[model samples]
Target: MGPKIKQINRRLNELATEWNSFDLGPSRRETHSFVNSSDVIGRDKDKENIIDHLKEPSEDGNIPVIPIVGIGGLGKTTLVQLVYNDDRITELFPLKLWICVSEDFDLPRLLKLMILSVNKEENCDGLTVESLQTCLRSLLNDKKFLLVLDDVWNENRARWIELRDLLRSMDGLSQRRSL
Candidate 1:
């Protein structure tokens, strides 16, 4: 592995070990079997706004990218999860995908994840970027898909453009919505 990758792996291992050693007390939050819309308190307005945006028609013939930007621990993920599992959302789009794009913004990995999400049996290993893009384009052709890229941390505009362009290449892919 490269030096940067090795360093990151080592840091991740250390963090994992440190996290496993932590034991403060019992959990304060109540665990639920499922999070209904009612479970998300004080976010009705946010939910409505997002749902409205989802229902809005795109005038530019391009996928609408709605970014929910907030600092950590502000229930950003919770809000998204609620929207993702919402009944209206589930019924609106037939194909739904949730991808958590954390610190590492590897394009190939993200593409592979999308492909695997849609076609679970496909072997994505040893596939080049062109092939992966082709697979994604083929899978999403003439289909309305809802893709949620959560926890995105990458700031490289070029990388984002490359990924976005690949997604746009799919037939009828960029004419709908994204989050």
Candidate 2:
């Protein structure tokens, strides 16, 4: 039989009031449908390589910064995503972050996304980009993280570099997983 549990020890029933509340959004299960792809077309060798990389976070005495570069519609995103979600990878790096820099790249939006992805239990509402940057710095300052920036396309590479800098400044055994 299961072990018996303990009891509560509260005296007064103090009720708390909500202030500037945010809606308890739907779970990922309900919001975004998981695209089943176990039977998805092949990439066995690539998957193996990613697993190996995760095993050895360093290459040539440096933390490997792998950039899966290729032109559009070449399955770059798909390949990266597959590796990102692979069971072996999921086991290796406990912390993972994925941000999509689509055709239209925006700083505030990207910051909000990074905050939400890492600090799932916290709210990012009303936080300015600068504030977000500060908070991101604090959150990632000493945490080993894997950040993925996907689908980048812009005439000016400056925008991409700006975001990359912020990511690079993050702490912990962090590495950027781009495609």
lDDT of 2 by residue, 110-166 (tens): 798888778987577898878999988887776666667666555577876787677
Find the candidate with the highest TM-score and give its number. Answer: 1
Residue ranges of candidate 1 with Cα displaced over 4 Å: 1-38
Kindly list the per-residue Cα lDDT of model 1 for residues 1-179, writing each as its tens digit. Answer: 69999999999999888887896433333222136667668988897799889977767756688999989889877887787778888777778887878767889998998898899999999999889988888888998878888877779999998987877767775445778
Model 1 TM-score is 0.78
* TM-score of candidate 2 to 2 decimals: 0.66
Which structure among the candidates has the greatest lDDT? 1
Off by over 4 Å in 2: 1-35, 58-64, 173-179
RMSD, candidate 2, Å: 17.6
The TM-score values for the models, in the order shown, are: 0.78, 0.66
Q: Lowest-scoring 10 consecutive residues by lDDT in candidate 2?
A: 7-16
Per-candidate total of colliding backbone pairs: 0, 2
lDDT of 2: 0.64
